[model samples]
Target: MKSQRHRITDLRTRRRELQRRAATYRASKGTPYPVEVHLLLGQTYLDPASWDALLHSRGPAVALRRARFAPRYDQLLRRLEEAITRYERP
Candidate 1:
């Protein structure tokens, strides 16, 4: 039997693979991943551009990852948004 962490990690791994495949498909065929998977891996690293791309892809899997990882990514986005909002406030 797999440990819970292992199971979660496996799930996240699958999600990542799907995300990668989806990105490739979107680039080559202009489409998103066929299957939408949830459960984000805690250690995955994505740059802002990739994050934005994923968000804009509008795939359910992306949505799931967004929801799961929002707590982490959202903090950074929120801070950036706040800084922009403050800086623009002449």
Candidate 2:
């Protein structure tokens, strides 16, 4: 069996890879999957400053912009699929 420290290290590596992937995707596409965007937006809302930024940026006026995220949704689905595959690869 792996040591607990090793498992924790592996998890951190995986998280770093995921964030790297997200950054690469964002750099190339200027946006990410809708699910990713949703997650980010949720996280943002949980912060006072980010929530204030969103509230003052466009709010309901730009909500329709979110509907145009089919490509990003596809990207997120691919990431989710990969995560599932990895988890099941015992």
Candidate 3:
């Protein structure tokens, strides 16, 4: 078992890694992903329902644009299929 101190250190390291990835992603010039996708990607029944509610309440979109986002849904579905295939019984 990892000591509490070790777990905290790991958490800090993971946080830094995520921050670095975010910075790199921001620097990239590819078609930008809406910050809202992370919100939309989140499922309401999950442990993070409070966060999902907050994100869903506020839109990165203007009043003219609805907060609907399905951009990553297909890709996520594909990945879900792949994962299910991996666990399928012979």
Candidate 4:
């Protein structure tokens, strides 16, 4: 009845608040790295062998080039994963 309606209204408000927080986070902390490269690095994190092979086929120097940014990508992934966990919490 009235209690149920109030519960629903409260949930909707919470949802809107979470959405706003996510939008603000994205605006302020968006990654400067290329999306394609980020996705590829994600896959690399998951499957090192496949990434190694792909990079190997591309060129020997390619891995060296990416090595410079490996730490940065790792940091970015960790931050993104933590953000996702926070967003998923009730």
Candidate 5:
């Protein structure tokens, strides 16, 4: 049986480890959006061009990935607009 102080110390250590994992993931992976999305965000309509074009230039796999990215990116932009509208009311 662990003492109360030891249990508390163990729990705190566990929490620190979990926080470190979370921080590392966010730093490395840039959560909520992929590197492809980030790269495209500044470009016209999030780059990618058209499905057929992408398939031709890049490949079927990249075309497929970018195809899914457009709508999700637009949805994220819409949500950002909504949040701005809701929060920035004068």
Candidate 6:
């Protein structure tokens, strides 16, 4: 039974961490794609679409079920991870 404020704070913290990682990656590789992808992911985590879906889900059981069926959630996360991995390669 986490409070909404805590959840929002967690999301913000995750976004900030992603941005920091993106900055580090950009500094190391001198590329914009990794930065762009990380920023996009951060934005996505804060977007209304995500909040609306989260709000609709409510309880833990329903939230898990909603996550399993959410159309773009997994795809977007996977794409972000793939982009980061590609950037990490020499």
Leading candidate by TM-score: 6
Off by over 4 Å in 2: 36-90
Clash pairs (backbone) in predicted model 2? 33-72, 34-72
Residues 1-90, candidate 2: write the lDDT tens digits.
763334334433444455566556657766445564446433322244533442344555434433333235335555654643443343
Question: Candidate order by lDDT, highest to lowest?
Answer: 6, 1, 4, 2, 5, 3
1-90: candidate 3 lDDT, tens digit per residue = 763334334433443444444345546634333444333223211234532443344434421122122223334433433433333323
Q: Model 1: clashing residue pairs? A: none
Which wins on lDDT, candidate 2 or candidate 5? Answer: 2
Instruction: Score every model by TM-score.
Output: 0.35, 0.40, 0.35, 0.35, 0.37, 0.48
List lDDT for all candidates, in order.
0.46, 0.44, 0.37, 0.46, 0.43, 0.60
Q: After superposition, how far is residue 89 of candidate 1 from its true place, in Å?
A: 49
The best candidate by lDDT is: 6
Could you give candidate 4's per-residue lDDT for residues 1-90 as a string of tens digits? Answer: 343324333433443454455556556777343354335334424244644443444454654544544455446555554554454454
Name the lDDT of candidate 6: 0.60
Model 6, range 1-90, lDDT digits (tens) per residue?
655535544554555665577668889879776565856666456566755656555778756655453435445555665666677677
Clashing pairs in 6: none
Lowest summed-lDDT stretch of 10 residues in model 2?
41-50
Clashes of each: 0, 2, 0, 0, 0, 0
Off by over 4 Å in 4: 32-90
Between candidates 1 and 5, the one scoring higher on TM-score is 5
